[model samples]
Target: SRILLQDTSAVPTSPWTHFVMMAGSTLRKVKSRSWKKQRHFRLLEDGMTIWYKSRWAGKGHSTFSVTEVEAVREGHQSEVLLSIAEEFPADLCFTLVFHGRQGNLDLVADSPEEAQAWIQGVRKLIHKVQTMDEKERLDQWVWDWFQKADKNKDGKMNFKEVRKLLKMMNVDMNEDHALHLFTMADKSESGSLEIEQFVHFYKILTQRDEVWKVFQDYSGDGEKLMLEELENFLMMGQQEGERSAQLAQELIDSYEPSESGAMSLDGFQKYLCSQEGSIFKPEQRDLHQDMSQPLSHYFISSSHNTYLLEDQLRGQSSLEAYIQALKRGCRCVEVDCWDGSDGEPIVYHGHTLTSKILFKDVISTVKEYAFKASDFPVILSLENHCGVEQQTIMAEHLSQILGDMLLTTVLDGQVPQQLPSPQELKGKILLKAKKIGGLEDCIDETLTDEVSDEEEANGDAESPSAEDPPAESLTENDKVKPRKSKSKLSKELSDLVLYCKSVHFHGFEQARLHGKCYEMSSFSESKAKRLAKEAGTDFVQYNTRQLSRIYPSGLRTDSSNYNPQDMWNVGCQIVALNFQTAGLEMDLSDGLFRQNGGCGYVLKPDFMRDGNTQFSPEKPEERPDYKPLRLSIQVISGQQLPKVNQKEGSIVDPLVRVEIYGVPQDQAKEETSHINNNGFNPVWNETLNFILHTPELTLVRFVVEDYDKASRNDFIGQFTLPFTCIQAGYRHIHLLSKDGTPIPPSSIFVNISISELT
Candidate 1:
């Protein structure tokens, strides 16, 4: 079954060999300033390993495992910078980077086709190994169950024994179904089944059930679906007019094997598991949300501690973080400015071992990459820690780098009652920091008097008087305290805070009654939650005209993020998240913002923006005019599911979960199903239903997960869409990666139905 090739000389002649073999004399292994004097190399073990001979006698011969290869990409000849002591002429080479390898393995190929063959062959071999691993696990599971069900000392399982086995596997079988399986397995019409017969019976039973369920869901009456019905189901309102029927006919012709105009169960299953079966109509979709709302009226994509690539402390801070965050459509970035040893101010996590980058360099990077991905405004959440002198330099650098793009004055001549819309602030940068009412008010009167008197009486005052205590005589506790300095904002930076001026939140009443133009406030997650609980109505009312930001708590040293939906429910616009971490919370954030062409802004719903409406996240009251809608989702199957990672002997037990998030009454109602060991073509045949009170404000998310017995379930992929956008009927749901990019050829088949409740 398996064959190993030691070198290019001994090639296996078996056509059914487990691995493909390729031998070439031009192949040379290059590593670390020297080419292994090896001219002959052989790709063996299904491309999972490679062997090379240094001499004709194979004296210096070795092999390396290719299963742990990280990347295999094309390499240029110019990349060979070292002097080649050996006289060997190589045409082209490709590099292979392994997980724990010290240096890259560069192999020479005679032609482009040869290099491509190796690359493609290795990728296919890896996939085959993964498939075999999954098969082995499933086979072992079936054998264990068979052994347990044998009960008696016989090597075969009788009808009663088979029934018991079905019950243990959670399949409720009737006499008719039981007899059908027994007759199919017992080829000699015997009353018992041998081991081979049992295995064959188990595979057929699961496959047939899956096929029939899909057929029943599509075709009513449990028979084969007619051509017209198949066309209608696949179209599912995606195609328009008579063209849909024609397209459906074309699909049937391609998938259907028989001349009969009716589609069989096998044909139906094949079509459902293909890329053509996907229900996501990309053409009908459009970013039609209103973009004229005020900047505060939209939920912005924000990042907390944007400089840190890891933990809050002992993390490496770099300008590249800003570049990455901006490229990912983050409109709001945090900058913690502290005094650097050099004259320039630096950005880093204060009171920690985090590295620093020049504030000017950060500003320059932001200026270059700010509008590259999104043209909307960028809000610099400046956490000022530097003194007045360095703060002035920060303002100067921002002014010089940002030039005319910085907001130096109010959009209109007069201060409006509400903040300006994002459309009005397009391509502009806003600074958010503590507002210094006036420069003179920040200085202590005593310190000012001392300075003024010293300058007025130039050199006339004595260094020390007899009444003054001697410096050496005073103890540490008795020493005079140094005057504490107040933080002051320069006029240049203060002027730039035309819209995003940071202010302290006193209380609900004060902020509501006296909040003015450009006076925004921020809250930590804990404090924000507390405020939402105690004064939900007041917080929502205050945010109607002002902007509020919520960030992760200080206790989250791992730079983890809190759930943003809770904050969004309370009308918080800037709910900052740790962009570096990837998890369910980050997935939800990414899914929510995948709309509007990922411009990093989603408009708040009507109820939250309307001041006259009284809405609270803590309380729920029935809307007399608003009717509830029932949503039904049938989890069918998945196709070409991706592996979480490329490691040897890895398998995914995939499951699907449907979730609904909205107001308190319509809050997260989720139902999860069991996992199928077969990740490639898993069929759940489970139906989930939900009653949605606020369909307009609710979001529906479908998450695929991998079940693990000993650890938490790993996320496979997920896709989300607003409730209003979901179309009813048999449709395919295309899954998206955590970063919101479409994973091609990976999708889930589902039938969705929505009905209004009386």
Candidate 2:
């Protein structure tokens, strides 16, 4: 095995670090209580991977890398571990949580000391992996592949093993060319190469010709890029403008840099692949947008059924879900309340088998994580299904648990003509629920109010009947009524609703004449899409003053999501989707909110934010200041994509698809033809073009899928970014898994061109 560091002699070896590695132990691997089985597990000699096998199976062992683990949880942190709490002591149990929706591995140690040794040992390895530099990380990635390719476990790879490794890495190479590189790296007639030789082979194989071409264009000579050449490249090639010289010096010092202010081809590649070289503008990744506008003038990062970790009907309701959502910069989260078996109100899907959590617990979670991701306000969109008595209890919990974090009274002691800014409401939790009338209607002592708008508030006038939703391929159970008929509001809870008051969305004209800036309406996806289609200009105009929320349809029982960009195109602010579900829908939502400091709010374009704006999703071209852009993307190559198939001999044939989501005319996709038997480093020099109207609302999604003829293409990885954030230059797009988590080192190199469409 290859050493992770250059100097191993200087490092001291601790007893606890190797306790699990040197002396493998038998731990009880658990899923359900009925499925607990003893397994032999140990960390490998490389200290980067874990090997485990069922005690009963002679040669059926499985291995996963330490880098794959997102975190390590203790005791009953997971549902599976919680289920078997009675059988195992809390101190003796732990769970390994993998990244990107992979099921967790729950285990029970024979003793607390053994559990601690395993937990601490694994965590130490994880920390070391996390702190590695990009170059070191790349080295780790290569080592992982070497481990996988050395099938005989002889600590060396023969030509046959190297050839198979090429296929496993998703590379298709000519036999003679592969042999030439292999022989050169081997440097001996042994015909068997060790770990160092494999690393050398990878370096020779991955010489990025495309990046070298651009480097040569700017460099006086291809050997190195001096200060002047780098400055010019940043100015002309990367649009760095006035900061080009200073940024060039910074890049040179940061990446494979030199004190002499010169950058080699490798250093140049490193700079471009770094966050500074990403197609996304680094400035937009901070709090750059003006945040003082009224709440309705921005798009909010939101989640529907924020308490559910899985599907609605039977998923577990967890406080962790709320924490996850808030930590991901979700400024708005839905809480479906119900009358619990006890006096306290509980949160869960009303008419489903989903587990329940105490409402107070949810409130505590909200207070803790509301400002963790962003100091902006968090709207707790409450769907009240409880009686007046429990609703009062809910109010008490909200007041006591959230304390000062809850916004109980209106700012300025009275409702204003317009809503408050996210800047003004920072660190506060705003309640979004049915209120009696207006703020004046709420009396401190006399709190109960009549329920008058349930019918209208329940569904938009144009919303397809819940009983007959738009055609969606879903299980019957997904249609389970998520709430009860609207109940009267408790004065205590009603007072907490200062800004986001749920009301019926009447026609556009009615709202224009009588709408309160503090008033907001929730629309099912179908209704929102219909309104966006029928009244695109009006929808955009109305959103400027009052807030509009678009949620997934009731038919999404599987917790599926609709495209949020459609609603965003019409300037809808709170276009909520199932954060628990991962796909193109959530990708677009994450992409939009990913910028502006990830503060959970993105200011809409100037045209969309103006009260009298003529911007319309339907006729974007007709709007003033409609600078349509033609985007051409040259899909270069994919690096280190995750394997789609787990089987030993199954290599992937991948294809890249570039998709645009915006107004009707702007929504299109073009794809590259599949490359057969390659997933390691697939290349496709194909250019895809998109003409984008409403560029402010447009999102470009790059999807890499393993092509299959007999079945649906298997998803490899995807990346989504708003067109407005895209930088025109040679860039690297780091790809994410289906669940929107980074699959490290899996990225695509692309050449971007954006120009005026005229």
Candidate 3:
């Protein structure tokens, strides 16, 4: 192989010396007097240049001469160099080798695994001689090769000559073997090796005594190192290694693949290799794709169980729940965001503040959780329940905090100005619109209200009365009616489909998670068609139970029917993740099914081994019942509503209370009251049905007639209702009394109505 030199030996005595690297045969000796001016030498080939300078030479006033001491090999060039250093350095001091110099050593490895193993072995050798105590033995061994390989007594070895010597010695003629020699010989790599080439190559191959010694220095006593230990080592090295970890971080931060911030393990491994070497041959590297190959990495519990962040993270107070979710094996973390007035993003599940949780340190906690990226490298699919502007602000905040490290997607809103642009992160930002419709809208407001009255009547409104029974379920053999409709799936969801395509366009690994099931049918058709037509990136996601049920006939995963994988190559892709748990029964007491619980299920680790694994039995344990509904009322109008306090004349909206009639006489007296003038002003709004009272009242009364009829659907019984209104705030009013109570009046009653402020 050809070698390049950065400095010339004649400059050794100068304050700062330089080495002139060129084709071994083209190098000329520098005149002693010209040493001061020859601080550096460069080798040029095909308009590319490799420079060698005094800076590359060790701390002493010493140098080496580059010369062609061997004949060129059939497809390789070899060089030889004579060193005149005061003392041998701890490590091998040679230049780099270039592919152009190899000529014909173009033996390629079909798989990346083969290439990685071969390269790692060579790197180990270089490290051993650098930090160990066998410097003298290493130096002597190399020098001996130099003398033995100078076949013509010309003090230089050429490429062809080196190959001839290897053949003469019966060396194994393999790509790995050839690479070892080439790397040692062409350090500066001016495309040809000189005396130094043969010297380094021979020592690396023939120095049996020092080979094992080098391995011992870097090995962990023949045991594999823990990941944490390796991580620490990597971090430390990045901080203080030859190239510095900062450079690697910068490169990673600046990278923008069209689709995602998450790099596949395979892709990242190649990146790591490239950072160390001059070139990265991903095809030849043994890349680990285990972590990123799954379509979906989320773990679901078959049972209704609630898992709290406190239960995970093993007790790291500062860690966010989302971060803990990753530790718990949840590959997809769903975050519900509502825009705040200040443009800040808030995470909460309910539609209003009374049902919300506000963490004072939410932002900082999120940052900590976000730092543990890659655990869920796909989209942090954010559901926006507020205004579009607020959603945009949230996206902006996320981008500012995460930079290029987070693959964030906000659903149902236009992107905000503050967030990193798709241009900035190289398309890391993803947007998916919500899909709503079909059976979702079937649960109308009246139906929801009827659904909520089961406890009151001590009976459920039966599904489709016997006289007018429910319609027969449709089947595959049945004829279906055609209807004109747009998929209820929102633009945000559509954007996700597009985003995945974009990721593939930019050559990145991609994934997604679809939780809603209402528009499944239409979504499946349109998204699949669009992805096939537009975005060509692969989609790896865990389908909901509903989706899987629809897939066989609806999605057609078989290649014969739909070549989803082909879509990836063509710029569209789809991969369904299996999530069938045939036998795991979860405890309802585990809180998984709580209205706003963190996780909707829980399972043992063994159950999560594979998609096909069944859950084992749990020991008998205590169970808890906590699903009882809690009720409170709000005033949308009248005097009980939110007050406009103008000290001189404070005005408040009216109060509306729905009182239940049944319990003790004392309780009835405590709860009932007569509507005094202060409360029965007669001014009303649709939301004000109960009696309104002044702020000074201890209690007031409402005469509600025929209240019993409200308790039953399709029933005609009616009873009087009476209510007491105290000076409680709008939110404190009674919407429903968990335990039925009595009222004062015997004939009066009231009606309830839903209200919207605007």
214 in model 3: Cα distance from truth in Å?
A: 42
Number of the top candidate by TM-score? 2
Cα lDDT tens digits for candidate 3, 1-758: 02211211111121111111232111122222222222333433211222344544575332221111111111111111112112212121222222111111111122333322222322332333333322343344345435545566665556655655454332324556666677666787654456656656654554322213322333355232223333333345222234334444443444322233333322232322231311111121222223222222222221000112221112212222343333222223334455555656555533322223222223333444332322223233333455545544554555565455544343223322122211232323332223222122332312221211211221111111122111123332221322222112222222222222110010111112322321111123234444333332122121211111001112222211222222111211112211111101111111111111222221112222233322111110111211111122222211111112223222222223333221111112212222222111212223323222111111122212111223421111111111121112111111111111111111111222222222
lDDT of each: 0.67, 0.82, 0.27
Model 2: lowest-lDDT 10 consecutive positions: 1-10
State residue 447's C-alpha deviation in candidate 3, in Å. Answer: 37
Over 4 Å off, model 1 = 1-231, 234-285, 438-485, 623-625, 643-650, 736-744
lDDT of 1 by residue, 295-351 (tens): 767889998888876788788786646766786789999999888888899998888
**1-758 per-residue lDDT for model 2 (tens digits):** 00001111122436965876657889999977799899999888677888999887988999998888866777776656767888898899988867665667889999998887877777777778777877888888888889877877888999899988887776777899999999999977699888888899899998878788889999887899999999999888887789999988888889955566699998998887778788788888889988898998899999999999999889988876786778789999989888988798999887789998888878876776688779999999998877889999998988888889888878887658888999999888898887776765653444445655442243322232363333233344433333445446676677777788887665677688988888888888887787788888988999999998888878788999998888988899998888889888988988988899989999998998889998877888798677888899998888878888877678888899999998898999999999888777778989998888778778889999999999999999998888889988789999898898888788899988888876
Pairs in clash, predicted candidate 1: 279-732
TM of each candidate vs. truth: 0.64, 0.90, 0.21
Give the C-alpha miss distance for residue 645 in model 2, angstroms. 3.4
- Model 2 bad stretches (over 4 Å): 1-15, 30-37, 74-90, 257-260, 443-487, 646-650, 709-711
**Which residue pairs in candidate 2 have backbone atoms (N, alpha carbon, C) closer than 3 angstroms, thus clashing?**
169-680, 170-679, 170-680, 286-597, 447-491, 478-557
